[model samples]
Target chain A: MGKPTGFLEFHRELPANRTPSERVSDWEEIHVHVPTDTLKRQGARCMDCGTPYCHTGKLIGGMASGCPINNLIPDWNDLIFRGQWKEAAVRLHQTNNFPEFTGRVCPAPCEGSCTLGLNDDPVTIKSIECSIADHAFEEGWIVPDTPGTRTGKRVAVVGSGPAGLAAASQLNHAGHTVTVFERADRVGGLLMYGIPNMKLPKSMVERRVRLMANAGIRFVTGVEVGRDITAKSLLSDWDAVVLCCGAAQARDLAIEGRNLSGIHLAMEFLHANTKSLLDSSLADGAYISASGKSVVVIGGGDTGTDCVGTALRHRARNVTQLEILPKPPASRAPDNPWPQWPKVYKLDYGQEEAAALQGADPRAYSIQTKRFVGDESGQVREVHTIDIEWKKSPDGRMHIVELPGTERVFPAELVLLALGFVGPEKKGLVHELGLKLDERGNVVTDGEKMTSVAGVFAAGDMVRGQSLVVWAIHEGRKAARGVDRYLMYGQSYLP
Target chain B: MSDAIWTAGEVPHVLFVGDESGCRDELTAALGAGWAIQPANDGIHAMDLLKHPNRPASIVVVLDLSMPVLEGFGFEKARRADSELSHIPVVLVTSHAADERVKKFGARAYVKRPIVVGDLAAVVRELGEG
Candidate 1:
């Protein structure tokens, strides 16, 4: 909007990334930073459309196509283009508490729904947004805003992921004494452990945590409510308790040899790998190492791709990825039009790395693992697989049918199961709390995002199943509003 | 099976177990003729082949985590329990990337399905060198 013809003058461009070959050799980020001058041009590309669909945060085609938090994209873009970076940061922070995290790891549905992308490429809103927030950090502009006055009310935020962080930040800003409880050794649940450093660096998470700490948000790591501390005790101690614990349970493969040695969950590998790297500079054998072994990754999704990339860095003997679904079309299908989330196939960074190293993409589509084969010593040695065909059953539900005579064997010294998660772990915490679960096993909540129990609220992956980080932040912000309204008007303000 | 160079000398001999023909064909093509290719129809046959005296001395074994007769974790447990095959390095491959059960089993390497021929060969070479 700053420049009337800016969109016409400049094309959309993203920061250059390290070549797949070079990036696969180490556990460093693949993207390289673009210069401020170039970033400014990208920011200027925002047309400041009258009806900016990018910020609507609506559901289209059963998928979120815009910013879930409804980030003020045009406002921040204009501010950034005008060189008012400090103002841009403030504008970005108005809606999103952690733009830096989203800017790095988010899939950017906002860009997908961008009006600019209707015909041409979308404006580089995400990159510009990230740059503005990162620049603010560098300039020390993102200082903690301690509440001037303290409200008598105290709030307890369970879980320290994006949702918990947002709830705590908002509650603190509202002058409530907010304390965040995290079960992990460190705060930033998924941000700290679930996601690898190469993607969302732990330093970024720590930097934000430090700021939140200065803002009167007390983050109590290793303190799990409902277990270490009782939910009843927390309710008695605080004016309100918000449950933001994310979904921590991984979906399992219940095939024949599920209990075999050498088969592992993707999160187990990723979490341990990150913990080891953080703890001992990669000296400890705490992480699952793919070095000097043939590796097979199951489930072709972001997690699987991450495993592929991580294994390549470890110099594994070989890598193979299997997916049950049929291969996606190279381009968007007729059903998937513009402004809808494209259901097309694209190589992610990890796949690119695997392809570069092995001279081919490491994905097998329409394949299903039948069982795990063990060696004489009871260690997993091979996997039995069969081809599957999708068919519509009499009930009209899609089901997979194993093809005839398509079975084969593949060697796998190590198997990292990258299957998706089921729901939040319902063990010590959830069981003790006695929270009601939905049909899908997620924490059940009403229209107010509050659980059946009074004075208690739920949000993020704990309420939803395993989901994107962006959605978690969105739910967290909404849940904070719900908690605030609940405290003041005895009802939720979330729409 | 094609008249290609089997660089078995430089490349590690690995037995691939699974029922997907495409994956096996792709791996054979990717590893090229340099490495010895042994395919097993099911877990039982794979185990039998591993115990056979004529079987090539493979330092590394690439196995799928899910299979019949003995699949994934079952095969790994069986292999580790046996005094003969416990020492061989094993890799578990599957389509489920983040299954915690696989991680709990302690596979040396966890490979996702839809094997990239080149990446598989590179990993195999690295294991051989190790």
Candidate 2:
């Protein structure tokens, strides 16, 4: 490490955010940029621990604890401290194809496993990495690396989300002609539409896409391989096909009045809102609005938080987010220690915004929506809800049980179901290709990441179901190695 | 030719249709008074409102590209096929501004979110007048 005494000299410091009151007035990102000097200081805090658990990427307590992609955290942090930003970017790109996306959205499990965090604060690894990546973009250090020679073999990657992008980038680097097929009008699936612009600006996504295009990766949009172009056609034209289609199917709340006019899936709300915002601002009502309405958001996850933040920005008269689970402890529990993801209560941006305007956190823990109560006109007016209590079953597993006399009516002109996704939609390409599916309905692949069909592989949410973007990139890279071995040696390279 | 009766401090009605509820709320709050707002949870309901004989005149439809049971694109295609709803202007809102589909589909314009309300309202006002 460049600065041996850096951790002793500097305490961990992250970039401050705009005050909640000032930021709630608009939809811009809340976190302000930390000056280069402050970021360098934060980077210097990397301890260069002997074990370096930050990059170990092991699963602790059934949750990811470190960098799944094994990003060279200490190396990059040291590079940033030494003013070697160009080298830091190079090291960052070695493991991650899109640090920009992860820097903004990833939970940064690396910090959780940081050695410095055991005693004091973690080395602001996430912030330092983002700063280096952003600096690289500004200095024109990040550019497309075109293959030295064309391999003549062609590969078709379905979906243009992170997994597909990573896979395509790697395979193209291996000198193979790669074409990414997207059902939507654009390539970056969730990155393009599901994620809001404030979190990840579309300009950044387009910038990388433009560079990839320049590198000879052909992005074919508005093409649904199953319907628009048959799967059979893909097998005939391309030597290999990679199914990176994300878990696009959302889980629905099957309850009374489920067909009400105002009830919607969280992705439906997020996808539409992003589309409207991208289309022509508020000129076209491509998204749903919550102005002067009482909004009820179901489920309590990142997607739900996104809904809460979006609703608060709409100036909803009232907003309430319902979570079936009990609120987490404010600090890490005894069982949850260092090097494990701290399952503690922390306010995300959306909740922070909602709290600023609504005078309290919008979330209602241990509550479940029973039904949608609609007006005579069939528009949703309210939601019937009940408080639930968790009880340990005979087997010591937790189960939700409704509490008596805890029923209440919540006014809700707009209701968003923020429950997570199930799996990729099986119709169209999946059904046409007849890909093998696991018991849970996710695409089934062997340890080699190969589907039942020959020369066909799957990765990302398509195989693993809905998961973090970092995991998707990891699977994509691993699957690319598997594909490379299959193409060259007719065997699997993944161990 | 005649002045349309409007709610006090209302600019004009702008209807948002799609699924993500949070984003809709943010847009509405940001665009407060710059535009009156209505939201449909999905595409079928939005299409029904657009085709209604008593439909709010001069209202803009902000359409999301994806949805269950009649997504924004499907609604747009169906609206284009309908003689009554076809004239209404649709500003396509999306996460993917650079997606080729936006260009091919010929939306009135594309706007990215989470956008500042002032910027969003300005775009709506421009389209409303035109």
Candidate 3:
């Protein structure tokens, strides 16, 4: 519920972004602060549609159509419109463990299904949510809620990504002694490494981790559970264990010249860049630099976009992104209706920067990389490609048809493969714990998020495939409830 | 009653220039049955089609902005410099934001990609009729 006629009264407005030309030169966040008045107007755009789909958080057409964690969007919108900033933060934190993270990196599927978006632009829900969270922190409203009493139950959470952190925080709040184990030296896994600083600043992540620590949640970094201590010891030691180790097995492009030196996986590039940037402000000689080199990024998802953006910041001479599929339609097609995530073409932040600097969008669709050609010194010199057509066969399934005589080559000194991850690696933790895995190679769990082995639970990318931070948070909260009930005689108070 | 027979040169045609064949094929099918669609890989190939002596009675040229060789603006510049080709209307399609810079290219019409089929067809028809 919002101003009764807010939809008609105020148009949706978001904070302005720093110019692409300017942002590419620095690693600072791109968005500028929007005045309080402008944000309140944005909040007014939320409609009191009898059935709001923005909070449904369902999977429609195989993509998220709304807030995955079921954030009480309309309630917060009404609160913010009334200038109830403190109350808005309270409502936001009630559902979302970390609104700050989602605010920055989330694609805002909630806006996609917003009733106002049916005819006009949607409410600036993501920005409003982020602002409220940030305001709460600035006002000293957010602090460690150290539980009054501790339940002697000890819970060991493997990995320190969104999922692990959420589980550790919630379980700690429920009075369980929680210790999170992270392999990386830093506590925040993907937040610290997977995501670049330009998108979600590491400072914000460190601040949240500090708050979580203050809440009595113990974080152990540079110590991988299965590798350092062994999964057997973890199961025997802790009352309950939650495996939040993400699907880090990146899918590879196993073609010719795959072993070339210049070709690197997307995560290896992003992780090292962030690490070096934080360690010495990149003064240390580390990270895969794209400076003065022709960079070619393969794949066309958010990860690929991140690679493009990072390469630009490195001052790559030129960047080209290749996508195997055809570009999406400019508008939603018949099969993709509203309330379903709109599969339409968009110029993301990276592509926008690329277009601004290179004078054209860097992405080339309907093309497939045939091979990577190496030079005399065994460095990737060129990327061989050919045009492809997606045609429907007699079986009613689409297939790729390569066009002959359409061979082309893109000069490349640096190539980043952002093809995405396949599944959770089943080598160490899952293997040693004797936990069951699904066909997709993800750890299997029951409705309660309990794995095959008793006292062992899994969530996030470990159970689900690599997904958004919002979904990971949702899974983590659910698993906490499962762990709580198991320890509390079939009852849980950790919603 | 005499039946009217038509030759390839007599049929109305649209010179489709762009590297993405998917967009070209989708638009070809959407325009539905009146005109001939000539495919060109880039602005250079598009020029070859425009300069052909036996070219069809072409009414319009639809091209993608970010092409491999001779992009839409480059093609527009070359077309405007040539008197014979300058008369043909040009339409630009792009995935990026259509700003003042895109408008300044002097295209008769520009459509953002994930293109709206009906909207593009309507623009093409209006330009052809004029």
Candidate 4:
């Protein structure tokens, strides 16, 4: 919309990524900043279409199609086009409670649904959004928007992940006394530990936490809700409770030799790496280093990708990611269309870096690990794999049929199970509260975002199962509105 | 019209009814999100698009509240009154801050302009049942 013919004039381009070879030497962010003038030119390609699908948070073909929090994509695109940086920040913050996290880590589904993408390359909505948010931070336009009047109400948000932080932010804006309880030593759950520092520096997460603290949201870390203070006591102490506990029960690989010493859950490995990096800048030896070892990452998703990147950073001799599913087509399939989430092959930053160093993609698709072959010292030394073929069974259910005589073994001292999470852990908090769980083990909630228990609510990964940061923010905002409604009979100033 | 949306197997056909350039542009932009978008100046033109070969198995209507020939309320009424268009759901797009006509016309959702196009697309998804 900035320039009527800008789409024709300018091609869809982003900041040149730091060369894979140079970036792997350290844990700094991989992307280099593009000039402000270039971003403006990119914004000029907004096309002012009658309909913009980029912000549609709807699920198409069972996958996310647009920004889940429904960021006003076109508004910021226009604002950036006009170089009205501050106004763009205001519009961005209106929807996304945390754009910097999403800007860094999120796979940009909004761009896939871009109107221009149907004809040409989609507008660089994510980059533009990031530029606006980052610029806001640089200009010091982002300050504590603390509520003017106190509502004399108390709300406790459990687990200091994206969802809990978002809920706290909204409730604080609505003039409610909010306290976020985190079991971790630090405030951010996944943001601080689960995600590696290179992608999102912990300083960014800390900056937001400090801002929330200034905005009147109190954070109580190193305190598990059901353990330290029983769920019943918190129910009495706080007027309303929101469970933002993430789905962190990592799905374990039950293959033979799972008891091997070197095999670790993806979260455990990442958590140690980040904590050690923070403690002594990787000098404390608190983390499981993949240095000088052949590492085999089981499962080929974001978690697996992160493991590969982390192992490479630690100077692993070689890294291989085994994916159970067959490789996706290089292009979108007929069933997968525009505006819907495309199932195309993409070499993410991790895979890109691995390729640059190893001279090939680190992923080995349609492969399954049969067992972790260990050495005499009882440490994983190699992983045996077999090829798999998926076919429809007689009952019309698809089954993974093992292909014959494709057995192969790869040397490995470290084997990280980067398999995805199953659901929220149900032993402590869920058991103590007696919360109702859906068939898939997620907390069940009503239309009002209120859980089965009265005045108690659930949001984010706890309710939606494991999902993107954007959805967590969306749920957090909704749960806060529900809490506000419960506190003041239908008079919630929360959006 | 020969675009990615057309190449994709099948998608919901959205009939847009409005008199302003904003409405036309909105319809044109919606095309990028892989919908068979049919733009009409008013209710009558929209109905014509629905009758042609573009007659989609699943269709949703996006109507602007105010127009020259047929207003949103009239368009919805006419649509409901006719048997052929009764099953089709309508979503209202309005520029006015305080528009209550959408409620009267029974639009599934109303997206205010300085619009986020995603809102309209989301409502269409809900109504399209896709």
Candidate 5:
């Protein structure tokens, strides 16, 4: 617990983000550094209840209501209140393998489930969590904790995303020889390419990968499991195999004129922008340029917001995000009670930046794209859309009804589909290994996270479909335990 | 729970232990082809479906925590007590997060409220295949 009267004495506060006009100009992080005193006072506001739901890591309303990895949140919050930054970092790392990544990208479900949120604002848990990790890094508290003794077994991890990395880290710490196979030229899967640098600096990903490598974890980049080497070969070579290959199959809007030249998946636009930016600082001109173009981003999710932000950074003429779902309420509805993730509307970083620059928020809610109108040259020129209403039928099933005479068109040269992912790509390693797929096309796993094959296990988005990075880490850790137990004759020391 | 086996049509692959509402049809549609869904008013009806001798070979039970007769926990207790049905996987659906005790009850996974079709389908399919 924190200070007894801390919640009463102090109000919840967070460090102000960098001015959108300023931060959007460069690829630097959006947050402005907060003073240690301010962070400490903020930490003191935690009212640790008799039963803390912040670390329950439970799913409510099909969404994460707390920390997915179940970080000892109160302990760390108390530690931070006492100004014991190092101890806070230790408590964080005990559960989350990479607080640095989560501290940046996580939507802070912990805050949503904070007991204090029942009345007043919740504790500034996310900012405090981030500050603890950042402080640890600055003071050199984080390092490669190589195991003293090595187990004779070897494990192979496919897809070096959050899940793959978490599994690899845990397995290596358990004294097993671990090899992480990544298809990308760089180490991180989504961390490297899927996310923009401004959100999660590539250096952070590289730093962690470097530490793991130093701890004797072999990273083989640019090697596809089913293509570079056969999945059968990996199964034969390693004592156990874990599939951390993310659910990368992006959902498509296969409407009319989908084959137009300028239409691109959100990942393609993001991956190239980051790669080119990192590779040559955009001087090489290898990315799909949004410069001087009207950008239309379909699907109003985090990925869509990222596209909007990136398009703004590229100095797009204009940007608009089309969301098929109705706008959420400004405050939590009666049904979305305490300890449940409040289904409320709030502008994300990208939307904030867009609003700061543009006259209005760049989101068009309850709209559906009819078709992409392309020119004779096959370059997408405009996006046709119509407003829609959502109504629950007599049967209690929600259905979309297109509104009449509400058609609108927006000029666009670039159409980014941020409609989210379907599931793991089934063509390569998943197919080669003959793994069973769920109805939604995610890899099917048993209770132990083991796939249909005895020696092979799957985790993360690959098994759970497209999900948060925190959940990926959770899955990765679980799969590591499963793999360890199998290799050690139904015994495992991994937590 | 009755021991009467299903005789007509295909024995349902899933025993949905929850309210008799739109969720069953929604789940059935979301589960797509090959999955035949049979609804239960509560845990009691679910037990009867489980006890059927002609139940599908790869059947799974999707239970809701808050229900009328023989709730999810109670059904789990009775199901686990039976040696023949103990190994079958059960996925729990709830509006709030279930505590760690659910894992001790042998629930394979949890699907929260405001259910996403894809997510529920994935969990049920994985548990069914298991």
Candidate 6:
């Protein structure tokens, strides 16, 4: 409520993005920074409702309706309205461990739960959050906060993804000597490899990782917890060990011609592409080439969209995404009202690029692939598909029903499956520790986030299954708190 | 507060137990289905609506689970414990499909949200059948 008429005076405006033509040619982020003046006006648009729904963080309708980490939305909005940059950054960091990662990647459930969204467009909370973080970096407000005293306790974090990094950072803050072990050649797991340079530039990940290193947190890359080093040794050496290894066991499509040469998991395609791009500027001849090929990506989530964008960057001849469900409505449906995460159709960055290069959106809704038709040499060259409709069951549940006489095929040389992850791979460290997994294959933890074993804690995707980056950070922070309590006998300093 | 309550109708009631937009429109659609709609800003208000006799006899309590004051789960618990209100069936109207978790909370049926008025009416009629 900075300006009584602020919501009326200034309409919602997002910061400008680089033209698709300019951005798709290179591996850089699409968004351009908006000046402080525009941000202040956007901040003014926040009604600051008596009970701001933007930070409630409740799981409404199975999706997060607000900030998962519960960032103080109104406080930061007010700070921006009052021209408090450093204070805003500090407030932003109070709840969130890293807003930079979220600001760039999170789907912004906060905006969906905004009170103004009841009638008018919601305030640009995500943009404001990103601006605060970027401004903090530019002003040199972001620096290492090494603990003044030592706790004489050691913790080994199993993964170097957001969860592990956040846990390590928080544990370091509590004066516990912390070490992060990453299986990958570089520190970041999904952040470094799964996501492309266009969505989140590698420099940002490196910058944050470097800052954490400067803060006295030790990082050891290429040292896997179960293989390079034994889990028993890690458990014996460290006072407490927290497992943050993510759920990466991807869901696969089992069909005829599944053994074709061209079909690959979305992560494999994305990981190899990113590693090559980073290692030798794509001169290494390592990644699955989508160039001069008609690619059919078999999912419609963030990963599939990333594949589409990656293929476009590699100058693919054509690309199509097959979505099993029908296209979502352009506007929020009645059941998907405010504060319940509006399930409206939105064109993401990759979809936008595809639309710009091609004449239409690359997705085909209500379609299911039956088989992978291959060429003479066993390389996939075509995909067989059929249209479908949803039918209600006796239990009143909706199920996909294939339409009659709608079978068709597309010429596809490269096929990527982005059907999402099943759960954490229950192979290495998990088996070594004899960790108890839930029915869904995720590690089972108690109220204290500790596994069945004493002095061993678990967090993030390994425990909760595949989830968003924000949840990983939240779980990491929670796990850090649990680890601290176990070390200090119910007294903990982790926030 | 007065607009959210109406005592004149003989239609079966479906209490919308949340204050957000999804709750509002669902209740409004319930009214269109010839059912008396009771609006409670949160679970606390919902509990208040269920206790009084002047209110219509509610057949199904549609829950949003994301209310501010008293959560959807807590509200269902309080309802189940009460001798007078325990028998009333609940239809969980949420974005995600209702699953075993909803059944644990005493929900009889569910309508996946982004809800169509007709679909909700159909489910309510089916679940509300004698």
Per-prediction TM-score: 0.77, 0.78, 0.79, 0.79, 0.79, 0.79
Fnat for candidate 2 (0 to 1): 0.00
For each candidate in turn, give its C-alpha RMSD to the true structure in angstroms. Answer: 31.6, 24.4, 30.7, 18.1, 17.9, 21.7
What TM-scores does chain A show, candidate by candidate in order? 0.96, 0.97, 0.99, 0.99, 0.99, 0.98
- Candidate 3 chain A, which ten residues in sequence have the lowest lDDT sum? A485-494
DockQ of each: 0.00, 0.01, 0.00, 0.01, 0.01, 0.01
Task: For candidate 3, give the lDDT of residue A413.
Answer: 97
Query: After superposition, which runs of candidate 4 have C-alpha atoms over 4 Å from their true positions?
Result: A394-396, B1-130
Candidate closer to the true structure by DockQ (higher is better), 1 or 4: 4
Task: Give the residue spans of candidate 6 off by over 4 A.
Answer: B1-130
Better of 1 and 3 by lDDT: 3
Give the clashing residue pairs of candidate 4, or none.
A50-B25, A50-B26, A51-B26
Poorly placed runs, candidate 3 (over 4 Å): B1-130
For model 5, the superposed segments whose C-alpha errors exceed 4 Å read: B1-130
TM-score of chain B of each: 0.81, 0.79, 0.85, 0.73, 0.85, 0.78
Question: What is the per-residue lDDT of model 1 for residues A60-170, given as tens digits with 9 covering 90 to 100?
Answer: 887778888889999988887888999999989888889999998888889888988878889888898789888999999999978765544688999999888988888
Interface Cα root-mean-square deviation for all models: 29.9, 23.4, 35.7, 22.9, 20.1, 20.5
**Candidate 1 structure, TM-score to reference:** 0.77
lDDT by residue (A1-495, candidate 4, tens digit) is 778999999998998899999988988888877789999999999987787789988898778898888899988898898989999999999998899888888888898888898879899988888778788999999999788766567899999999999999999988788999999899888989998887888999999999999999999999998899899987888879999999989999998999989999999999999999988899999999999999999989888888999999999999999999899998778899998887889898889999999999999999989998898889999899999998999999888988899999989899999889999999889999999999999999997789889989999999998888888889999999998777654445578
Clashing residue pairs in candidate 3, if any? A329-B114, A330-B114
By the lDDT metric, which is better: model 2 or model 4? Answer: 4
